[model samples]
Target: MDRAPTIKDVAERAGVHAATASRALNPATRAMVNARTAGRVHEAARALGYAPNSAARSLRTRTSSVAGVIIPDLRNPVFPPIVRGIEDALREAGYMALLGNTDGDPERERELVAAMRGRQTDGFILATSRRDDTVPGSPVPTVLVNRRIDGGGVPSVTADNAAGVHLLVRHLAGLGHTRIGHVAGPRSASTGWERYRAYLDAITSLGLDQAAKAVEFAEAFTEAAGHAATLDLFAANPGLTAVLAGNDLIALGCYSALAELGRTVPDEVSVTGFNDMPFVDRQRPPLTTVRIPHYEIGREAARLLLERIGSPEAPTKSVVLPVELMARASTGPAKPQDS
Candidate 1:
């Protein structure tokens, strides 16, 4: 009773063979066992406080049982939930994460990748991928999170950007905003480019007013970049009644710009953002935006990377999750124009 509970003990308690108990306990192989039996085995293991010997498993498998996760910046509110999900998924699979923040610097990202590789990590999940990245492929199994490249040879998990953008445009149009401008993110990033492309398509298809000055690109995802881009967009298209920002941070910039230009949101001008990140609802006038499943995206990315580590020759796959539009106080019926 005093000794540490073993798999044998768990099996005995679960009323199953030790081999069945082993398979049921392992996240990778649990699918092969009967679902009811697996649940019983997990319950018995939990009751007995039996923890798998990860160290011995690593020795036998000749793997570090560690995944290297590289993200752009943890400062972004959207990424923390994602990282938490990744850690939870990896931990369930008896693996650990070696995390690094690249701060959107290519050199720093490369250095972190090399360092993690040297540590004998089992695989990698990167959230800092760019569309035009020219770097050679990774030596180990790799999966991208929240972004993808142009060719799409690698596995990745991302939100449905085009669908999300279309929802925003349609909502604004329903509000009678004929002149909608866009504060787009950097085109180098997949999220930015896809949203921008979708915006153009949405406007043309919806028969909204479109012009050369209706769009401006932010140098980065930061608020400062959004602020500058918004100013430029408004200066060139003063008649715009609505603005769609690439992300929540960028939307905050639009709020500041509109205020400085003496435009009241949802009154003189309506605004919407993407990524419905944390605390956006707490803004002066709660932001209307698109909500992507940040946590699920991370979990999916980790799951894909683990599958690749188990079977390296598997064909690459991409996962695009759904998104929702959150309408709030920031968007409203367009103001009436002077006759």
Candidate 2:
């Protein structure tokens, strides 16, 4: 069996000191050595096919160059794009990402955080932030993504859910939807409560006092919860012509509820969703939704986490990305009978 190439082999080939060869191989230390010596070391390493041990490199620098990402659930289609963005950005920056899914359980989240911490991850990018979290002692450079920890000073990157909800309400009102219904997400999440408040404020500002009663809350951010909430709203106010769902998955549930009631989308009842998840445009009635920059948000969160890891004393930041409305077949002018 052939032995693996070593730094000594590269040093001999380049006629340079072994320490110089090692320093040249490291990106951080490469600049300290003369450019000509570094070039010779690189050439010799390539010629000898010398590969540095990652474990040794980590031990030398006390940095793993890896970030831990904790998400609520991976089953949601919306998460895949976000994960891809994070991975791509990290790869480009010569870092790696470790992903952990908690399935939306607080205990599971705590376990995952502990496991990542044990692994000595440089920092964390968290997408699950409960109103009350028991996970004590976060990573030094942790950054909350898409959710904010209550009373915690961690930096965060989140969509402007309030502004997005305001856009949805205005769109519905413009389409003559005087009575708009809302299927609010779980209040335990920041996005949920923020969106609910935005809905109420928009309705009052639009003078849709008669429509305010149609808003209803969902127990969770799931299709089943959406379906149940939509049904309850329909029962309470049969005159509602439009509904703004908490998220795309919840919007899917609204579709099911409307189908069960023999109602047609946009023809009888218009609907709008948040977080324009993939394949939403290909639904039976292409869903109209607010396009939150999920992938961009993830990439930005990863970048922020990296910055925080580099400088823990940096002032914490709360980044709120903008959103846009994508008009589709699911929403249209309110039915004449709605009024």
Candidate 3:
């Protein structure tokens, strides 16, 4: 009664063997035990204030029960929900998340990965990976969230960027916007590249091939970058009636750039954005954008990473979740060229 409650104590209280109690207490092995018996074991452990010694289990299993989650930036407003989903999924499996922010720096990302590996993290869920990047010497499994490599070497969970972009472009074109411009995100990231490529493809398919010339690439997926790129895009093609921003942040920059040029949104220039992140709906004119399931992206990434961790030899897989178009006040019938 004086000493810490042991597995034996828990087992006796639950009328089960010590091994059964052990399996019941562990999330990984809980499925092997009977549901009723596992519940009783859990109840017994809780009643007796029993806590499993994770250190001992780690020593035996060679797994830290922790995952390294690396993201580009937390300020973007889209990543927080994804992170929350990852944490929720991991916690359900008796695992913890070790989070890091890379701020879109490759060197910083590598350093964080190394530090997390040094701490014996079981695997990694990266939201900062570039298209050409690789974890060459990584001994543990890694899954990509919201970003992916050029080829299919690692598992990933991403939204359907191409589909989302095509949807936005079609929506704009349907609004009588033939002269549409694009402010693309950095080309290095898959999200940026896919959306940009999709824009060209969509325009070409719609017989608006000349519209592709009115495009400018942002340095990063940030408001300032979007602002600069939008200005460049407009300077070259001032006749464009609609602007399809690479993402929500970029669309926000369009607002500032258009304002600076004295172009009233949806009157002179209708605008669309992607990743319907956070408060875009509350902007002076609510932004019309593609809605990706941010939280589900994180949860799916966690699921893929856990699958890889459990079965390291399993065939690598990727999940591309669907998206929806959220139409709002920011877009409307394009003004006539003379107007």
Q: Please state the error at residue 223 of candidate 3 in Å.
A: 0.2
List, in order, the clash count of every candidate structure.
0, 0, 0
Model 1 scores a TM of 0.92
How many times do residue backbones clash in model 3? 0
Show where candidate 2 strays beyond 4 Å: 1-53, 134-139
In order of appearance, the predictions have TM-scores of 0.92, 0.84, 0.91
**Rank by lDDT (best first):** 3, 1, 2
Question: Cα RMSD (Å) between model 1 and the true structure?
Answer: 2.2
**Candidate 3: residue pairs that collide:** none
Task: Arrange candidates, best TM-score first.
Answer: 1, 3, 2
Per-residue lDDT of model 1, residues 1-339, tens digit only: 899999999999999999999888665566679989999998998898888987776676667878999999888998999999999999877788999999999999999988987887888899888998743236688998998899888999999999999999999888888899999999999999999999999998887645424999999898888989999998988888899999999999999988998989878888999998999999989999999999999999999988887677889999999999999999999866710
lDDT (Cα, tens digit) per residue for candidate 2, span 283-334? 9899999999989998998878766765678798989999999989999997
Off by over 4 Å in 1: 15-40, 134-137
- Determine which window of 10 residues in candidate 2 has minimal summed lDDT: 131-140
Where does candidate 3 stray beyond 4 Å?
1-17, 20-51, 336-339
Among all candidates shown, the one with the greatest lDDT: 3
Relative to the unseen true structure, what is the C-alpha lDDT of residue 337 in candidate 1, on a scale of 0 to 100?
A: 77
Per-model CA lDDT versus the true structure = 0.88, 0.84, 0.90
